[model samples]
Target: MGCATPWCLATLVAIALALRSGYAVSGLVLVSGYYFPTARTDFWLTSAPAMPLLGDLMRYTSPPIISWAIMPKLMRTLFAPRAIPPEFKNEFPISLALRPKQLRAAAEESAFLIPAAAQLRLQYRVSGVQLGSCMERLTGSSRPTSRRLHAVLPSSLLHLVEDAGHMVTYADAAGIADAVAALAPSAPVRTA
Candidate 1:
């Protein structure tokens, strides 16, 4: 986590500079869970009638859809950590620990989920790693969302493998250099 902070901070700084310089930012969002908005639903509804209605409709409609459309994946995300064999954990550097307290917190706290969801959504606009990697790191397991994200994310986007199973980190020096070089404008060549 400590090693990855600088990389995350640097990316944010780069993004701010890019936006300030008038470069358009766009991206895809891939997450295992929903990201609720910061503002109250009533406030949002007053400004845009469609917002609250959509959310309310989703709340009512999503149950069936989630059961049929989302449950399999969600189950995989919940259970994958347990499937990791004891031998495998011994062999690999990674260790999966179940902390029900943290899981409960994540389930209840919008703050924990919102940023991750936002990051996934933003990935489509700016090249980034698949969301699964980030989730895996956070949950200490390889989630189906991570696999789905890899399949869904376009090939052009960059993938940063971080400590968290589904978290993306930009600590790869070569990758960072390459990205910077690619984004940096080429100097005009002068004929000798």
Candidate 2:
């Protein structure tokens, strides 16, 4: 265990030197103090003292190890912005449809239904359910369009909608099972 400290230090020094010299290093190193060969008695006695010195040097270079090591790469990736294509932007005419009150009501109603739909796998049965609320909140008219989409969805899909809030009532569960059974192909007839 104590030996691993020196070995780890040596490894970090090598990495720092290599990185400074424009070299690359990869793969993992394992160091154990207690298991297999003991670090102090086995590795230290067998290896050069300079190895531990390098490890110590590496340790002194930084306090927050993650900040010194990995954060730069992550920060670079995250802060770099990208542009969205024009074709992907919203063009659904949400501004012309719903009033503020209707939009708010639809948003609340959809919020209640979205989780239930997810829990019951209702999305697999129904298509065009807009689980997004941001647009409705921003435009204050998109809620009616969202509700219309939900309301006009086929009975096959609507059968999964539970009256008892997000929970699937016993009746709803039975109805879903029946609907699934009706849609499932009949087993081929068997003749003996």
Candidate 3:
């Protein structure tokens, strides 16, 4: 009935906003997030849908012959160490993610990420809002390295889920809920 994952980019937005003086945020739960990023081959590949002539060519083209064949494998890899949920496989609108407009936005965000990180890097704040990182304990993931993550969120508490990967959101809903609840304030959160 809903998206399986929260839009992870919102974490970066929060961090950007939080870096400003007196930006009050009560809490943040960083789940399998990216920080201190580098452009990847996937960036160039996926960005085809966002390029000018290629964007038109891609959207009009049927089959997207390559992605059509490889998407399943990519999806499976994304959720490795755990199987993609039937609901996700059935209900997820892969087309939405592949659409030219959406691809453009994703590309824009990916492009912006590096500059955002570079600008925000090493900036300190007097604010001490609660921050935590959530991920499944797996051999591989798309998440930021722990050392880099700690540099970004120095105060974050780690909540690692066993036998899962970056897809920890789907791996254990209860565990994620518990982590969020732990970040929840006993009283209502107030922001300045």
**Best-matching candidate per lDDT:** 3
Tell me the whole-model lDDT of each prediction, alpha carbons only.
0.34, 0.29, 0.60
Residue 175 shift from truth in candidate 1, angstroms: 2.0
What tens digits encode model 2's per-residue C-alpha lDDT throughout 39-90? 1343322222223455344333432343345534533322222222233224
Clashes of 1: 20
Q: How far is candidate 1 from the true structure (C-alpha RMSD, Å)?
A: 14.2
Q: What is the lDDT, from 0 to 100, of the residue 157 in candidate 2?
A: 28
Give the candidate number with the greatest TM-score: 3
Q: Estimate each model's TM-score.
A: 0.27, 0.19, 0.76
Ranking by lDDT: 3, 1, 2
- What is the per-residue lDDT of model 3 for residues 96-149, given as tens digits with 9 covering 90 to 100? 776656656665665565566556555533446656554434454434444466
Q: Residues 1-192, candidate 1: write the lDDT tens digits.
A: 111122333333343443343554332222222322233332322222123455445434533344356544643443343343345435532111113332222223322233544554454345432212212234443234334434555453424334333223212335434544454345454799
In candidate 3, how many Å is residue 72 off?
Answer: 0.8
Between which residue pairs do clashes occur in model 2? 1-33, 9-55, 10-55
